[model samples]
Target: MRLNIHTLIHPTIQKLAYEIIYQKSHKKLQNTDNEKTLGMLIFYEILRKWLKIDNIYIKKVDVLKERRLSNQLDKYLIITNIIECYNILADVQRILPEPYLKHIDFNNINNSFYCNEKLQEYRIIIFEKFLKNYGIIEIINYLQKNNQINLNHVKIICLTCNSNILKYLANKYPQLNIYTIKIN
Candidate 1:
């Protein structure tokens, strides 16, 4: 008779497995038990696949006393918890449908792309159109409001794979220095 053992595992053990996969870090198994090693190896494989990273090597470190296990586990859990939160935020951003909502104005920053104060030295603008007006209006408005963007100050506008958008932006923002390239 075959018995399903997974259901018998404690909830904390299940959470350990999740952390092992999501944390993408080496786990120290103190006891060197067969079951524990097997679980860690499985977790390593899952992490490798999820991250799309190859050439990962897992080494078994010397185990500490049983009393120290709790402290080590606490450290691991803390690190993994932070990493999991960041991963969740990234996943949410990827799955979100609103691009405009993701947009952040950088005009106020001194060293941001939208800052016009430093345009005279050398600057590059990468253009792409997806939502509306090719997003050039947003950039132009950023520059216009900042009082720094000018044709004489701009060095190049790199337009990849969209000449029409480049032309439109050039016509609309005549004072913008621009260039175009078709990436194939």
Candidate 2:
């Protein structure tokens, strides 16, 4: 139940951010006035630096293939700045079940925090692709396995084009929020 800045962020991410921002590299961040806002920026920049430095990222770097990641990174940067809030998602992004949290926007993540149409659309793209690669069983397993809590506590996001799956999950867990592309 640790809840501090250091505990909230992973050591690797902290090191990457620190080294890139202050220690090894002399890169200037987008916002220097507020350190908290730098969390997401640094995470994205780590991806940038890895793309240039890491052997795997370098070899596997495909601009077209990583379009989904790039798209979310854009929204991540946008929402991080506009919302002025950073919590579990920033930490979870760098440290997660597999650090594959590209779909759920960190900003609008809350139990009662209804996602907007555009955000839902963005997530559907991510979820659909994920479902294609790894079937529903795997997706649910991953979602069910995650135990990290955001600032607003935490909740599992179930998205499906199948109304049957939605209904099944809803009836199974009434309190949980199961989202469709059309839901507000």
Candidate 3:
């Protein structure tokens, strides 16, 4: 899927996923069956709360069957449950988008700067872990390192605990496009 910063879920759901991951880590749960069960519970609870429904539940087998059917029909499986969500997010440690230099040619310039640049229009730096002091250093470091690139085209993707600090950051770095993604 062509997911941007908007693909992230709500903050409450993100916190719940973090809690699930923390529990799984402490218990050393290695079985996918159990993981799926736990994931289902969270997913069901979120849906129930959001929809304002009571005691809504779905079987793991049914979910899997629907996923397969969706795949057969050439449709995207929207919800892969919380564990899959966490796994997908955890794997992506960093995403430094390519800089769209108006005049610079790639033939002479060093390509070491962005070996994994997927999107070229905007530079996106992702942080799966908690931000250091609300990501002030990271933002500054990115701007400094990519001083050759224009700040207006950059998109800083991070997970921050504080929304107020995020607002502050948005104001502080008006040149860059800062996006806070919530973990699902």
Highest lDDT model number: 3
- Candidate 2 runs further than 4 Å off: 1-126, 129-134, 146-160, 182-184
Provide the global lDDT of candidate 3 against the true structure. Answer: 0.37
Query: How well is each residue in 94-156 modelled by candidate 3, as lDDT tens digits?
Result: 211111222212123233233223233233333222332443434344444655445544444
Cα error, residue 44 of model 3, in Å, equals 23
Model 2, residue 78: what's the lDDT?
A: 18
- Quantify how close model 3 is to the true structure by its C-alpha RMSD in Å: 13.6
What are the clashing pairs of model 2? none
In model 3, what lDDT does residue 107 have? 23
Tell me the tens digit of each residue's lDDT in model 1 across 11-105: 44445434433333355432323324433333333222222212434455864333211111110000011221222223321222211111232
Model 2 residue 163 lDDT score: 49
Ranking by lDDT: 3, 1, 2
TM-score of each: 0.28, 0.23, 0.34
